[model samples]
Target: MALKETRRPSIFWLMAWVCFGLLGGSVKFRVAHPERIPERGAFVIAPNHYSEIDPVIVGMMLYRLGRIPRFLTKASLFKIPVVGWFLRRSGQVPVERAGSAAAKGPSPLAAAREIARAERIVVVYPEGTLTRDPDMWPMRGKNGAARIALEQGIPVIPVAHWGTQALMGRYAKKINLLRRHPIDFAIGKPVDLSEFEGKPIDQHLLADATEKIMGAITAELEKLRGDKAPAHRWDPSLHGQSETGRIEP
Candidate 1:
């Protein structure tokens, strides 16, 4: 089934203008294989997390591809004044992480269902947060995206991007606008989860699905950067690093 092309909400336009004002002239953005995104379907847009500005770059890429991005954002951000209002008006979903007081409300999967019902694109950072990998490679991912894909029978489209980290450091507060940064976005084909579909959703199945999704994302990144990824992905728990953000050495 195809999703109808609807006009973007006012908030989206406002954000677009903001992104343009911030990134338009300073960043040279490039998107490869954007056609990989389904023209009309409810699909999970799983992308590798690299920098704080990654969402803006990825969102702009999708906007260029003619799709309004619906992100699965952290719930706490919904409490802020202007940002919260914009998020709600823009149709972004709030996801309550474990241990957060906001976790008492609806599950993220419920938000996924709402996105699917609307047959819109929902951008999910499968790594949950930014990559803790020392080399900026994609690390172990959480299972929310995989569960939603398997449960809803939707495609998990993997996307990879580079250069956002260069423009803004992982945890840096300043944006470097002196030089034009080249941001490259590559979209891979939909992950094949046919074998796991219709089966009981479990840890093992979710793990396997996540591996495939992350692997696909890494491969696309390799193509964009012309480099090979490490043999094994980094796991924060094993390295004794917090999973929320960058790991400080």
Candidate 2:
């Protein structure tokens, strides 16, 4: 007989979100504005990739809040001996990092579709890889998240995270909760790309939208952390215009 699967129970997700929100009280978590997204519907929770544990923490937050989020995880991870079993049972999608097949794999897309059909939330790390943002900011990303949003007609909510760097730098592979860092998460309003409707949904548009959303996230993050990001083109002081003015289709 096949081995039994280890799925993430609804109760577990609910409890996880609640526990995290409550736990966040001890730390310093600001929801920013929770009214941005509807409580129910198919939406994308796109957060920057910082710590490997970021996904779990964000997932726990949503789960505790009574929302189920599907994550796009690396395919290689599924090859691991026993851990892969747990991932599959938990309904996580394994993503190949290499070729076209990896980008548009049928199985993962199907899983994404199913999650949307269920009217649940999905978490995605758009950066494709951990940040190379010298400043630990989000790097340019692959637009799989945007494509998913367009195809499914779901809103993409940008989520910015801070304090994780203090918890664990880019080089650190584990969490140090005992350090009691003030982890920050700011969720931007749902981005509506309906204007792109009927047009060919190409990577260019998808990538552009993803960048815009991430940019919004970063701006919010900067405000919360009271830090200054590098003066890139997005920096208004250098351009005399807001980064939002530079978004491309």
lDDT per residue for candidate 2 within 104-181, as digits (tens), equals: 654555667777888777787776556655466666666767777889888888888777666556656565656466
Give the alpha-carbon lDDT of every model. Answer: 0.85, 0.65
Candidate 1 backbone overlaps, count: 0
**Which tens-of-lDDT digit does each residue in 1-249 have in candidate 1?**
122343535678788888888888889878898678888879999999878888888888887677888987888899999999989988898877677565586677888878987888888888988898888899999998899888888899999999988789887889898889998889899999898988899999999999999999999999988999999999999987887854563
Point out the worst 10-residue segment of candidate 1 by lDDT: 1-10
Candidate 1 stretches greater than 4 Å from native: 1-9
